[model samples]
Target: MRQPSSSAPPPAESLDAVQAALGAEHAAIWVYGLVSAFLPEQFEAPVGEGTTAHRARRDTTERLLADAGQTPRPPEPAYVAPQPVTDQASALAVLVVAESDTAVAWRAVLERTDDKALRTSALEALTGAAVRATRWRRAAGETPAARAFPGQPA
Candidate 1:
């Protein structure tokens, strides 16, 4: 993500939105870790990929906030999954929910920011989360795996 051009701080609304996105990224990393045990060995690659992607996004968000002189919010100790994740199917379902939440958060950032670089970064984050959610939905045998309007409320 690009740093703010001037020393002046980012807009308060934009900072808050980015902080929310950071929180979502934190929750996503936690979800990926929690689902590892429930997923089969064949699913290792995607799980690892998701974890890495979320971590990178999280780091970038933190740097952006810090550069703007705002302290980024820390992750919660634990997050409650939308559904219980006892088996492979439930695990995938929860992963879909996590990714969807991140997409929504990133989309909010896009709406709040007018900064060109910030908007570009937010769009990429939203798109990535949407794609990840679709993958999880497909793995769980969801009939319509792709959302018609990702980042929009269902």
Candidate 2:
């Protein structure tokens, strides 16, 4: 990738962190599309919401990278789920994992950046991921619907 203009001062570590989060968002959008097929009609609303949210975040993160003169990473053509999502149980399980991955990625951004605005945005994304994961867990009747410290490794 071409180096961003020196005047732009895009810190390599921070740019790398946001790029990782952007990739997670892309993967999330794709995962939601795939898992939606296995969800019930009642899940249509949340699924739609999740897809929309991820798209918005992805776009915003891309803009942030571009503003810093850094090239954003593109989405992959395909992603293999950690496991087969053939049923509602499996679908929810995969969704939870995807959302958790996003949370972790955003948290990495938070850790790498000193910019107040970027920190705020990363926190919002992280919180959103945590909430979405909790919702899926709730639907699956998993215990502890929310994590105490989301993005922290168990």
RMSD of each: 2.9, 2.9
Clashing pairs in 1: none
Model 1: ten consecutive residues of lowest lDDT: 1-10
Q: Which stretches of candidate 2 lie over 4 Å from their true place?
A: 1-10
Q: CA lDDT, every prediction?
A: 0.93, 0.93
| Candidate topping TM-score | 1
Q: In angstroms, what RMSD does candidate 2 have relative to the true structure?
A: 2.9
- Tens digit of lDDT per residue, candidate 2, span 40-150? 999999999999999999999999998887788999987999999999999999999999999999999999988788899999999999999999999999998899999
lDDT over C-alpha atoms for residue 135 of model 2: 98
Q: How many clashing pairs in candidate 1?
A: 0
